[model samples]
Target: MKPRICYTVWFSQRNRSTLLCEGLTATGIAGKPAELLELPPATSLLDFYQVNDYAALQAKLWQQRMTENGVFGMKANAPRKESDPIIGQLAKLSGLKVAAPTPYAVWENAFPNGKHIFLTRRNKIRQAVSWWKAIVTGQWHLEKGGERKVDSQVISQHYNFEAIKHLLLEISLRESKIQAFLEEGNIVPLTVVYEDFVKQYQQSIRSVIDFLGITDTQYPIKEPHYERLADELSDQWVERFRIQLQKDWKNVIW
Candidate 1:
């Protein structure tokens, strides 16, 4: 039986997920290269507002799998707090494992048998700014035009300075989750830092190939175009936001 690979992305928006997904597709795991969202056909006209029922949705996905000739990949943002339990139950019924980035330690704990992969970025402030841009431009989500009210208390709770530091914390948490899995010897997970993955794409891909137990004779990993932000935000603004984020990050974690 062919190995089934499900990639779980944990970032907010506009991160390097597209490049990673494209890379997997080019290597033939996805059969044909396309963005992550291209998988699992649209189930309803209301999909923009919400997802269809889990069991029915998975049934549709399983049906689609009959025609594909390689490992399957499905991507989604963080599961909604309310829907998580149902999704977990459905995954149990379908024999699928959840794959996602490192910061999902809490969620990973909930799905103890799930597989995990961590992707970290070097410049988090740039990432945050990019996330903001994607949100504003309607690429991440549709935002209605208005003066967006910034909740000072909420911002204080989750913001972190030096975006890289936040990235590191996320990495640390993911490493912890990986260690837990290792200690139990139930699953062996893979970790990929964004910088290292980019610098040594082939090596990273080989590591993933080994972890997934893919045959060397069959699917080989490929590199795809990793798009970078064309222009960076002003240093002064970045610094200011960084300070705010630092305070919030500290509050939430420590």
Candidate 2:
């Protein structure tokens, strides 16, 4: 029997997980076509299966994903809560592979046998600024061929550095949590930085394909068509907030 690739990506919020997944799905793996399965937040296996009893349903869903080619890809963003019945079920579930979303520690426990891909952003300041902006605007992703609206009032005139500072703290803690899990598990993941992936999609995607043992001789490798959500305010806000954190917090590292 030929071996099938089962993998999951552990990412932080605002790190371009969607873009990466789309690219990965484009490349054909073996004789099997790939599909990116996404799990919603706060929903569990029971909710996902849509049944009060799910032992059989879980297996059915898993078998469905496996398809004819036997190659499967699935991703989930870490749920908001630390521990949930659904999350625990996902971690322990057999047969289905897990995929992307930020907050990887929980999923790490859930899918121990699955391949781990760690996608991250190098610029903490920029990531923090982007995350802060999204929280206020409630706009996380931009649609294809859609225009991005920047709120100058909230971004420029009345920007909240204190709130941003706290948000940065949260981001750092999450990153550290993922790092600790990696170390404890002794798992060396296929690490892709957001900036590098943006600059070199082919190389980045190729690295991932290689990791998964996917061979594509005819697939046309292209960069994702999505537009960035952040703008000038994102850069300026990050710079100003960094300086403020240095002065007020004494460059606190928590």
Per-model TM-score on C-alpha atoms: 0.53, 0.75
Which pairs of residues collide in candidate 2?
11-102, 74-99, 75-99, 75-100, 91-110
Estimate the lDDT of model 2.
Answer: 0.64
| Residue 114 displacement (Å), model 1 | 5.9
Model 1, which residues run further than 4 Å from truth? 1-12, 30-59, 63-70, 82-114, 139-188, 218-223, 234-236, 243-254
Per-residue lDDT over 16-129 for candidate 1, one digit per residue giving the tens place of the 0 to 100 score: 655665565567644332223332453331252244664445444433332254444443444434334434444433333546323244333323324445455666555555
Which 10 consecutive positions of candidate 1 have the poorest summed lDDT? 31-40
Per-model root-mean-square deviation over C-alphas: 9.6, 5.6
- TM-score computed on alpha carbons, candidate 2: 0.75
TM-score of candidate 1 to 2 decimals: 0.53
The lDDT for every candidate, in the order shown, is: 0.46, 0.64
For model 2, how does the per-residue alpha-carbon lDDT over 147-194 read when each residue is reduced to its tens digit?
666565654775788777777777777777656656655778788899
Residue 65's lDDT in candidate 1: 31
Which candidate wins on TM-score? 2
